[model samples]
Target: MEAATLFPARAIRLRRDATIRAGQGGPVIALADASLQLPGLPSRICALLESLACRDVPEADVQQDLAADGMPGLLRWQALVTKLDSAGLIERSVLTPQGPVARLRQAAVGRGPGSAVRAPAQVKLSRFTAIRAAGGKLVAERPGGHAHVELETAVTGVLAALAGWTSAGDGVAGLSPQLSRAVIDLFAGAGLLAPGSPDDDTEYTDAALAQWSQADLWLHATSRGTRLTSGYGGSYPLAGRFPPLPAVRPALPGPRVELPRPDLEVTAKADPPLTEVLETRRSIRAHDPAAPITLGQLGELLYRSARIRRVFPCADGQEAADRPYPAGGAAHELEIYPLITRCEGAPPGLWHYAAADHALEHVADPGPATAALVMGARAASIMAADPQVVLIVTARFGRVMWKYNAIGYSLVLKHVGVLYQTIYLVAAAMGLAVCGLGGGDAADFAAASGLAYHAEGSVGELVIGTPASESASESGGNR
Candidate 1:
């Protein structure tokens, strides 16, 4: 009998139409249409179909699991179920005992292509297992064990007396020739003694251990011996220093001092000749306020300095890599914000320039610092006082940290140096002035931008407009 017979007609009419939205703040497509619109989505839908085909799903249970999966925000599940029903991929009937039941057939199981491939698994070695495999092996030793004792107490006295003895026919010398050979064999077996150079004389002498340092003798004893009357030889004591000195310690570090922010003002001088501007570019710390730069000039600086040049697929297709400034690993983590106080043809306000779009996103209109900006940027105050523009270069540490982990901080700092210099050179080449700044209140600046302070911390700042004084060039030249 048909399952529909289990429920009254009224129950069938009570079903509600469900819809799903995909992507945020845009034209949301129907769940069924989305599969056709996106290249790989049909495969995902097929995987979901395969999962359902393996189970006996009741109509209500199907909806519950879909909701629980939390994919609706990205893929509207309820709406997709409705589309599946309309397409005859699934049929629902009233199972009197179970209320509403969904009976999925073979037709639904073969609906779409296969899903995205799974990632390969990684194998790792455990620390304990690795260490247990290595029974015992000394790594290395630190210095300074001997108390200035230059001779080996273990065998030094025996070797010393053997020296200063002369031999006669058939008469034994101070050190028995047999004893010297025995000590050499014993020490060599223990790894403390090694055969001397080929040119070394076989005859025993007082200076047999002359080359050995105090630390070396402590490890193994040296030998002194002479042939007796059966052979015939003599030995003597050499001058010696009783004790050796210890190694010196490294010196202490210098006191720390608060560093000044990067200088950001362009000096007041003829916009250095155009040819010179190209050849001898300088990071100007003063600017020409009388000749305020225009919005076009600002755009040029942003693009030549850091605009995204190209984007391509990274190792995994999950995320893309964008190339803006040259990064060691194409980790373009630095970002820019323009604090526009004065720019011709641009509003006198603050803006966040999206590198991807090369368009400005209006953030807030900080009327004017009417008062001095914190940190005594007198020039910035003069900019606020006389009105000028400041550009901030910030970094999202997480973007870099994702790949480099511990050393990402170093890479980020180096990136800042390259980017700031680019701006400095570009500003000079364009007949404009720029000062790389470092002293603005980061927290306040972050608050004004409405982004997480940590996500976009101010790494450096630049001021571009005009110089503060006319005699600045003469002062700079003298210095």
Candidate 2:
């Protein structure tokens, strides 16, 4: 609740979020979100953990308890401490008979307790480190951090003033003597601070790291490579609390229009050869206004490019599905919303593709937000006029998030790209134009559809129509 003023007082306690559950033989330490079993607990370890749970116990008293135990308590208590420290279950404080120097907690999961500062002449926060507010508290973290530290309200100003490399003697915050060591050690251990020495030439020159921005590296690390491995993948942490989202989003309610499904055998002979489609694939930007795309063409494109082909049951009564395009874990999260501006037969509006039934549901009338989307895609592709159809691709995040952890959003992005290629190739084969835009405004899409941003929002965009010319020039990989 308060900034740490000193190196945490040298006392030991369980973290507030951590609870000790006594089992028949396996004693489990359950954090707010997870419970795990670990080794090296003394027979009476639960009693000690119970005491630590209620209040911080002085280090000397703990040693005394162990010493007073059946046998002089070096090995047993040491084992428990080792297990707790490795699992980040213990909150340690540095005490001086009268009071604690600073109460500190290691909030990083899976990362070992941080190393000591080891006196240095000069230190500076790492260039990659970031301090920001999260869940009502200021957290200090570095990209791919091995440790995480919380800052005291006072420490904010302390770290701010010490932004540039500074002497170790300067002392952080200056609120307490222990503040400097604690701050230095916390940041240093998290890879949030580097020594003033010029030994980081390799770090700077690293080709792998050099290509990454701080945010990209953070996402990559947190989603795949970070040291925070406790819940990195699905352990179904919310299994009992929440039900998994259905495999396919139920079709949106709307002014529905049934679409024609082309006979596969007829389409097979009607389409160009695979090699011809691959060689002629183009990112066509401008639509042929004179010969605007027809509803029939649009329906055929949706059917061939995205319609679900099969469904099979999965665990927990959930079902796995097959579509023209592949998805991670059979989680077909991509949904297509076509904004029709110059289509024949279909009125100008925002329509969602009902892949399961091969139909379109008019969800909203085209308006300012839709115009903005079209214009944005035009600008992104440098088109002279809006394409006949702008297909906004969105993901039902819960579909992947419920089944996958850490890499859920990343997998959705991969699906977006895969589906884009699917549409591109299919459109090429159909003798129609399609171009995947580089990016889109998720907020604008949410405004247009009246959809919750987090539940389902645009991740990618594709412009489709009859090409202005048989050959379309490439821009931003429309090729």
Which candidate leads the pack in TM-score?
Answer: 2
Among all candidates shown, the one with the greatest lDDT: 2
RMSD of 1: 34.2
Q: By summed lDDT, which 10 consecutive residues of candidate 2 come out lowest?
A: 1-10
Instruction: List model 2 lDDT by residue over 1-479, tens digit each.
Output: 13545334446777788877766557777876677775545666557768988787876677767775655466777667776766767665444434544344664655475433344556766666777786655777776665566664555555674576666666566545455655565466455675445455333577765676777777787787534644566555556676777666787875898887888899999999999988877777767778899898899999998998888787744467899889978889889999998998899988999888889998898789889988888888778887788999999887777777777888899999999999999888987888888789999999999999999989999999998764544533633
Quote the positional error of residue 198 for candidate 1 in Å.
54
Total clashes for model 1: 19
Q: State each model's CA lDDT, in order.
A: 0.42, 0.74
The list of candidate 2 runs beyond 4 A from truth reads 1-114, 117-120, 130-137, 151-157, 194-211, 471-479
After superposition, candidate 1 runs with Cα above 4 Å error: 1-275, 316-324, 367-387, 466-479
Shift of residue 342 alpha carbon in model 2, Å: 1.3
> Please, what is the TM-score per model?
0.39, 0.76
Candidate 1 to truth, TM: 0.39
